[model samples]
Target chain A: TYTASALAFALRNLPVPVILVGSQRSSDRPSSDSVLNMKTSLAIFKEAPFGEVVVCMHGTISDDYVLAHRGVKVRKMHSSRRDAFQSINDAPLARVDFPGMRFKMLNPRFIARGRREDFQVVSKFSDRVVLLKFYPGMECGIIDFLVDRGYRAIVFEGTGLGHIRNACVDSVARATEEGVLTIVTTQTIFGRVNMNVYSTGRRLLKAGAIPGHDILSEVAYVKLSWMLGSYPGLDRKDYVELFHRNIAYEYNPIHKDSLFPVWSHEY
Target chain B: TYTASALAFALRNLPVPVILVGSQRSSDRPSSDSVLNMKTSLAIFKEAPFGEVVVCMHGTISDDYVLAHRGVKVRKMHSSRRDAFQSINDAPLARVDFPGMRFKMLNPRFIARGRREDFQVVSKFSDRVVLLKFYPGMECGIIDFLVDRGYRAIVFEGTGLGHIRNACVDSVARATEEGVLTIVTTQTIFGRVNMNVYSTGRRLLKAGAIPGHDILSEVAYVKLSWMLGSYPGLDRKDYVELFHRNIAYEYNPIHKDSLFPVWSHEY
Candidate 1:
């Protein structure tokens, strides 16, 4: 799922479903989910209405059904579970039942099937982008190391509400001063980052760090890499705008309280 | 909640329950949870059997009850929800029902109340500990920076299965060589890291990076900070043993699939 959204952004106008599939167990294992996963992917290719990048995987530990999640919003939540891939801060795009092979749209916010006259592919990607997860007492000079190394962008997986420690604010400012794209996403993984709530977050905002609202840190890194690689001459204002654009539905406008998966309290 | 576990480790022989409470909304807000949270905390102080640090917070969105989570195993999951704090990789230690003030132990594993003649508090902490969250294209020199800065320990929030990008393996080895404690925890946050399952993880293990089994990165950072400060001249083997020890229940040996807060697939 980490690279799937990047592929979608590069393809820009995907005309047919691009289903990325993987199995937790090896093919030699009888319990391997590969066959069912591939069948579901093929079923989606023949039946689904959306024409975009999606991750197809087991919906449950049992072979009951398979889920197709939006590529940009999914993440590997479990280390070894067959149903590891999950949609973060969003719902799975569709579900395909096991024996029946019935296709159903779980979320209606996906791009509809269509063809574009000017469909173009930009496969280029810059490897200079980095993701730094912020914690208390982190060394601020690490930011200086990346900026000094000619990195194009640095994405920070900040703490709750999108905050870096007060000590790292100056390093963020220096990154921005060096013309490196500085972005902040929450390390919480399940909520949007609102930098306006706390003083630490506010200081980071003042230092010109772009808050990546509901986007996962991995997705943010990929998006920024693609942007830098695709538009080498993109101006400062346009670059920030492009980073925040919902081109591939990467940014969910409003995360419904019910969207939180198993957090019982959200109810 | 970040500092609660550290405080518990410092005051290892806690005689009475230390209930940490905080509100999502300000006290001035009509919907603030401060009063109810404080009440639940006080209720736990008077009646709960456990004599350890625990976070007391709203268990649900309404005034149903408040939960007491083991301080070493809880995290602020949501940005602003009243029930933001969650017990990670473990169940809440107990619950304090609102109005009824009924107290119940949800998890049986807890330190029982007792008097200790040798009780001592080590309030000292080392600021030389740093946490680095690993990602693709990360600059390896950041590890060098922390090690050269006289940092005592480096905790890495690595990818799935506690693996860093292959490019970082050399730097990790160098840190271990310099007597810097190198620890790796999973970024997945919900599962124990099994380095034996993948080559990347195995390589990290071979590099002398201690796998922080199911320990949250923040907790690892705090525990290390406390360990380094309290025992300044500790030997190498002793430090690793202390880290792996469940001094304050900081390590949850097994993480059942159901412990995952809201990932629907676990069911």
Candidate 2:
């Protein structure tokens, strides 16, 4: 999720559409939903409505439709279900009717297609970025290992609302001082990443770690990779500004209803 | 999830009941669901028919009841919600009614309470264990870092069915040779960890990575700590046996329907 966002951000000024697609079931399975999903995604791609990074997948298990979820707002919810992917905190960009081959707008904020002359590709991605998921009692050596190895960026998948053990705070600070782009996301996998809400988060922020907002950890890693690769000459302040900016719909202001989609009756 | 399972497994051979309880909402909020959930959990804990680690949470959005999910089988599905926790691959142990304070049996395999004389506490836990989540392009230095630090065990939260990058396999073999209990679980967060199903997985198995079956990564970490602390003198073969054994309902064979709940119908 992070890499695509970073790539999209790096290529934000361009007119090209970047769509990420994956199959929940293997093609060999008799009950596989990959064929229909691929066909629906291809149909959406043919008349691409937006020059942005987006994810295309089966919106529902009925094989009648597919959803174009914004790249940073999508997640895989189930392990093996045909319709495991879902949009988090935001509605999908468009829903495509498989039978009629018609596209219906869902989120009006989606960008529209522009002239082909505006297209550009910046494929420079740094391989020095590392993603680390934090757990209780994780040693500081892991952070030191990354720093010592000359990694340019580190994305942490922290517990709850972006928290890591206090013991590792010094290591994070050291990495930040050493010019590593330290970023924080949550393992909760849903909800916004806000570093200002709690002390642990604030400590991380003080240590020079950037809050990933609502971007998925994987996405954050990718974003860092792209950012580091494309803007190697940019200052830290400029990089931080670009990291926080919503260049391609990576961060969404969460709505209460999005958290309890199944229990809508309660509200 | 890991802490609860470790505590439960440590106290598994005892006669006392271990109940894991948490509220989905804060108590001070007007719309908070904490009070009812707590009351329901307390009611279940008082009678506590099943002598095992079980999680008590709202069965549904309704205020009338809660479900007792086995500790190792439960997971927090949503980022923030009253009904976020759910039994991953098995039915909950029981359902408790708030008004009547009644307990209805759900899963029949729940361990029945035995004589109180069998009650015992095993508080010792090994601190030399670490949990790592694998991602693409991760450097092998992480594995080397752990091995150099004298860590006795590692539980890898691998991508897809318990598979890691091929580059890390040799380090895993080295860890095994140095007497570290290397284990593999899936980052998918659902489904079994089957290393034999794929070539990469088979390679990991050949490198001495033990498949954690259906155990969650966090739970696997805790189990390893507890197992190592309790049986510090055991041989590798016996350690592997204990790792695979269903010590405290951590490895339940999955049911098809459990993967897709009622909300799946909408999808």
* Off by more than 4 A, model 2: A1-17, A22-25, A60-64, A97-102, A259-267, B14-16, B24-33, B59-64, B97-102, B261-267
lDDT of 1 by residue, A28-128 (tens): 89989999999989999998888889999998888989999899999887777788788888888888999899988888788887687646798778888
B244: Cα error in model 1, Å: 0.9
Question: Each candidate's chain A: what TM-score?
Answer: 0.96, 0.88
Residues A139-180 of candidate 2: C-alpha lDDT, one tens digit per residue:
787888889899988999987668888889899999989988
Q: In candidate 2 chain A, what residue range of length 10 has the lowest lDDT sum?
A: A258-267
Candidate 1: Cα lDDT at A194: 92
After TM-score superposition, the amount by which residue A11's alpha carbon in candidate 2 deviates from its true location, in angstroms, is 4.5
Q: Model 1 off-target regions past 4 Å?
A: A116-118, A263-267, B263-267
Best by TM-score: 1
Model 1 Cα lDDT, one tens digit per residue, B1-267:
567987788886767888889898899999999999999898899888888899999988789899998898898877767777888888888888889999888887888875776467887888989888787766788788778889979988887788888888898889989999999998888787888888888888888899999899899999899889988899889999999999889887766667865554321
